[model samples]
Target: MSDRAEKQTGGLAAVAGAAKQAPGRGLPPVHLWHPEHCGDIDIIIRADGVWMHEGSPIGRAELVRLFSTVLRKDPDGYHLVTPVEKLKIKVEDLPFRAVTLERDDGRLRFTTDVGDTVEAGADHPIVVETDPVTGEPAPRLHVRGDLWARIVRSLFYELVETATVEGGRLVVRSDGEFFALGPVGAGVE
Candidate 1:
């Protein structure tokens, strides 16, 4: 490995050690930790929601999930912050992707690619943004803190399939609340 890659591996190791020290009951309070900026890492989250490091895909799912716990998005960019260090990482799109959806007990829950389960309600709402240039759909769901899960195209279609028009808005009802997907007359697809 090059010297830069070698240096980043140490940061990863430090993050792994911190993850090991955290309690397994809930996620680490990354928002509270104001560690010193330790520069950027080689990690990159692709538009397809794949996590890569050093030009290769990270094969371990658990490790990826662990690193995600420390992820934070600021006005600058996304960073993986531990208690002692904060390392920035590149995100092509959103840091996470909602790959699956479940409806149970009149609640719509989304499962992210990294195993984060978020329900669409008052706490976690869904929003859609159309590209200004291409007019492509980009749907996102608030997960936690500043993190959001990108709703994949297929899942967005599924949402659209179950949507209904309410007050001239294309919306989906979850947990007794209506979330607008788009205007009633606009073609979301």
Candidate 2:
């Protein structure tokens, strides 16, 4: 491997080790880490929710899951953070894809590709923005701490199916909060 490639591999290993050692069984406290910024890594999260390293997809599911625990979105950009290092990475779109959705007792819970389960509510709001060029809706759900997951097409369709017309808008309720899926009769049916 080239020198840079070797360095990246070493960096990844270090971060992985730190993540394993992190306290608690749930998600790591990436938000609490204020490590100094290390240089960028050649990791890219594609728009389709595939993670690429050195221009190739990372085939190891466990590794991806481990890295996802340390992912944090700062004011500048997305990063993989450890207690001692914070490496910037490129994200073509959101860092995750909402693959599955479940409704339980009037709450919409979404599961992301990386195994995060988040319920849509005031804290994790769902937002739909229209693509300026294609004029299509791009819906997203806040996962945590400024990180968002793009709701997959199938799940978005499900949302549209269950949505109710309220005050001239198509809305869905979760956790006592009403979220507008889209304006009523705006070609969203």
Candidate 3:
């Protein structure tokens, strides 16, 4: 149809082939890479546009729509990273509520400020007895869900990313490089 579409459908295969052609984003330690990047899947770093079947970017609006849709459709999956591996949390840090994880071109960040911090009440134990003369357990933490991690990892999602709508181009990036998601539909809003 359009030049963008042609590139999206055809040359994108070569672009997808460049999956091995990893760019030097100089990413921080926190921005995690996806576990799988095989047939029909090209996961780019700090990229722009939508994720396509050919495993390439499908332009801007398309990418935004798909990302929003995936988020709305699979709210849980949109926040956490994929390839769910068991992580070690503290028992003393349990009995909390929500969590927030942010990803930038920099690193794979984790934040667990779910709810307001309440004073340690009688309902919860002040300290966890490990051996004999130990102290309190410590501050609590919660890992984000799977879908969220996938969305974050796949698109390099960030919470405070500045999105500027100029002349129809959506200049969206975290820290710097442009990014987007795939398998898109209409814009959510």
Report the number of the highest-TM-score candidate.
Answer: 2
TM-score of each: 0.94, 0.95, 0.18
Score candidate 3 by lDDT: 0.27
User: Candidate 1, residues 1-189: lDDT per residue as tens digits?
Assistant: 887878799999998888767657688888899988889999999988889998999999999998888899988899998889999999998999999999998899999999999999998999888868778778899999989999998999999888888888788878887788998667872
Q: Tell me how far the alpha carbon of residue 148 in candidate 3 is from the true structure, in angstroms, after superposition.
A: 8.7
In terms of lDDT, the poorest run of 10 residues in model 2 is: 22-31
Candidate 1 segments whose C-alpha is farther than 4 A from its true place: 1-3
**Poorly placed runs, candidate 2 (over 4 Å):** none
Who wins the lDDT comparison? 2
* Candidate 3 lDDT, 1-189, residue by residue in tens: 976556434433333233323334421111243432212222232211123333444365433222222111122112111222111111121222223444445432343222222222222211212223343212222122211111222122232133344444333333334322211221210
Q: Residue 89 CA error for candidate 1 (Å)?
A: 0.6
Error of 2 at 9 (Å): 1.1
Residue pairs with backbone atoms closer than 3 Å in model 1 (clashes): none
lDDT of 2: 0.91
- TM-score of model 1 (CA atoms): 0.94
lDDT of 1 at 5: 78
Clashes of each: 0, 0, 19
> What is candidate 2's lDDT per residue for 38-86, written digit by digit as tens?
7889999999999999899999988888999999999899999998999
